[model samples]
Target: MFIFVGCAGGGTSSMFCQRIAKAINATDPNLTATFGGVNEVLADPIACIGDHDLMFAYGSIDVVRGYSAFDFGQLFDAILVAPQVKYLTVTKQKIMANYPTIVEDIPSEIFGKMNGEVAFEELRGELIMLDLLRGYQSSLQTASKNADKDIEILVLNADHRNQQLAKVFANWQRYGIRVLTETYTLEGLYQFDPPADFELRLLFGATMQLNQQDFVRISRRIDGLIVFSETPKTAFRDWRQQLDDADIPTAILDARMLEKRADVTQLSAKLTDFIQTVEFQAEATAGQIRLPKLQTKKAKKQHTLFGIISWNSTIK
Candidate 1:
């Protein structure tokens, strides 16, 4: 079997892809795995058609929604239209279970002030679109009197990754790195806030250049620094010199290198646990599927999900 994995660019998807390859290989040694960014695959679906038996797409609902355009939607529609794709897997809930500390740190308000269940349903809607596409494909195939391909849509609950990541965040003093970037592309790294025990910060190159005082302030706060390969050395010369003068630990690595060293290793250890914890269920098309018809009840708001529960308000 041939499998394709896609996600938003940056290391999360790539790291997950590695773990997936290892897992799939362990189970069925004959299967082949291929990986690419979701946008790249969507942009060129023709090249992918008939080339793979399964496709796994990863990302937040926002990431998936960003790809929804007249033509782009058509591209995704084509995937289901073709008989080559036998299975499609995507997430239906937050990767990590909710924990009190995580809830307090990340703030559900960012997700439109939603309760965990509502937020999950909102995210799951994106995947429902995929289910609908598959249903449409099934209908067409049945209409033609062709043997229906048992196309399975696997909705993965990835709360374990979140739970494990919370552990990582809780122990950020050991795993956290102060990353310097030139743009907001790296903001995704901070989606989950780190614990207060570590001084986790992102310094924009231009901002530092314009405000030396702020640069100096942040530099002193950091005990170590990591710069991606794409960082302009000349622009950061003074900052690097300051780091050297302060005798701080520093390493310069390619963007991909940073992801592997900092993210993949920490996350891979949690994959087995993630796989073991995953719960799967079939879902109906978008219109037919109804959000849980329950009244939004007010209760004491506490950050708790998966296994990360906050006992106190203090993050440390």
Candidate 2:
């Protein structure tokens, strides 16, 4: 089989190709391997599809499948190849520094030809997993584009600074999902520029302490909610009670019993699944909505409506 090994840049792929080719060619002279930068190789469909039989794709295979020359009917397959497993310790450390979430437990050095084959085989699984994640991201993008209504989400946090959550928000935004991250402070609610519209809001963090008035205000803003139970504040309990009473579509994340906070991956996956499955219909007005205060009995009777729709009448 003809295989093309690629990396972010052509340099690493060259070394990998040399080693892989030497190992495979020793056994079967018919099998060949080549190297190139991933973008350059994937961009030129003629060279990639005409000369090579298979591509050792790193992430989502959508790009390869999109190739016009690719024949799906033929014996074609996308194989995932991870080069990190065979990397030197120093190189791995540098990679981990940038990608703190990417953790590889297995340690194997490819010293001999046999070791190279074994390491490559083990690394294949990692590539496949990466492909699956990329596929998930692609699905989100497609769904967002095709959705009749804009999909926007609010991420509530007590702490404003969380690198992991920021990355997750950024990823969702890249997939065409509008994200608004906010934190509750003594000063009041603080958030960056929010989306123009949102039908769904999700609440998290320990200090999102809400009073009865605060609860009523939020109920008007969101149609669906995913509430966490581990928070020490009674406001979370109150919020859940209100949502349950209103019969709103809500998902409860019970982390009360856990000894520690849930890691970023676990929480992000849960949020993603919830977003994908639920259909939100509540119409949140696209500006500041405030309930006008009523001082007199006549005013209370006249104010039958709530939010921006509320208006006053002339007694004439």
Candidate 3:
């Protein structure tokens, strides 16, 4: 199977592969299948994956999902590190496809050491980074693993190599997870010509970059455009209203805001009347923030527990 790892194959993807290798025998009938990874899973170990038929690893170059044929290892002949000297050549190799930029002056191993460990502090002084350093990534990533962040419990588009009607069905089945799967073929091949970037500043948090094609793409994919940010942040009502105006599907994942705030209850109640029960996990914890805050369903449920012991005290 083609094991497609993602985003510069880092510690997350590598360790994840090792975790699943045990229970899933590669020799099984499942061929050309895929193994998905989040920020923590790595797609490395593919070269060694004997159970599967074909293997593919994606992500930044760290410990796992090392590199491929078009990778830097094979690109010594072209794409030098220096800029402005600009020696552009036309070869079969797609330059963007072979990244892992000839990492600066530091030796590969030393540089690897520094990038391997990333940490940041949040509300509770909690530091988050890749769980799997060099060890195999554990295979226990739940939809709630990174409950503290605006984590999207959505499945991504799986391996798209096999071009067939069946392939589309498989993609829908895998990525349509919990209703996150989407399909809208581009009218034509498209690319973001000039690179795009942005900065995100929070009142209580530092200014960070909401800069990725991924986020840009989200704008188009999500209809009604409510709930701009990922999770935990107070909903930008104006933004959410705009999305509601556009009529998009929505859900609330940030459990923290769900606790103290119930303004969205009106929207939830509407959802309750028309549709079947939603798919939600009881294990959900309070965390996350998103913008625009408008993904109205059939119901905006506003339920509260209010009780008083009105009876006279009885002898116990």
Q: How much lDDT does each candidate structure score?
A: 0.30, 0.38, 0.25
lDDT (Cα, tens digit) per residue for candidate 3, span 1-316: 2223322324543443333332233332332223333222122333233344223243343321211222222111112111111122222123233222122111223223222222100100110111111011212221111232221212122211213323333433464422222222221101212132211100111112112323322433222211223442654443445434433334433433223244445433432321222113212323222223322111111221011111111111
The most accurate candidate by TM-score is 2
Candidate 1's TM-score: 0.23
lDDT of candidate 3 vs native? 0.25
**Superposed model 2: Cα runs more than 4 Å off:** 1-160, 185-208, 229-239, 254-264, 277-279, 283-316
Tens digits of per-residue lDDT, candidate 2, 41-159, equal: 44443454344322332322222221111121011122222344334324433322211112232323431223446645554454345434433433433211112333333334233
**Stretches > 4 Å off in candidate 3:** 1-144, 149-268, 272-316
How far in Å is the alpha carbon of 284 misplaced in model 3?
5.6
Ranking by TM-score: 2, 1, 3
Residue 284 CA error for candidate 1 (Å)? 32
For each candidate in turn, the TM-score is 0.23, 0.32, 0.18
Predicted structure 2: lDDT: 0.38
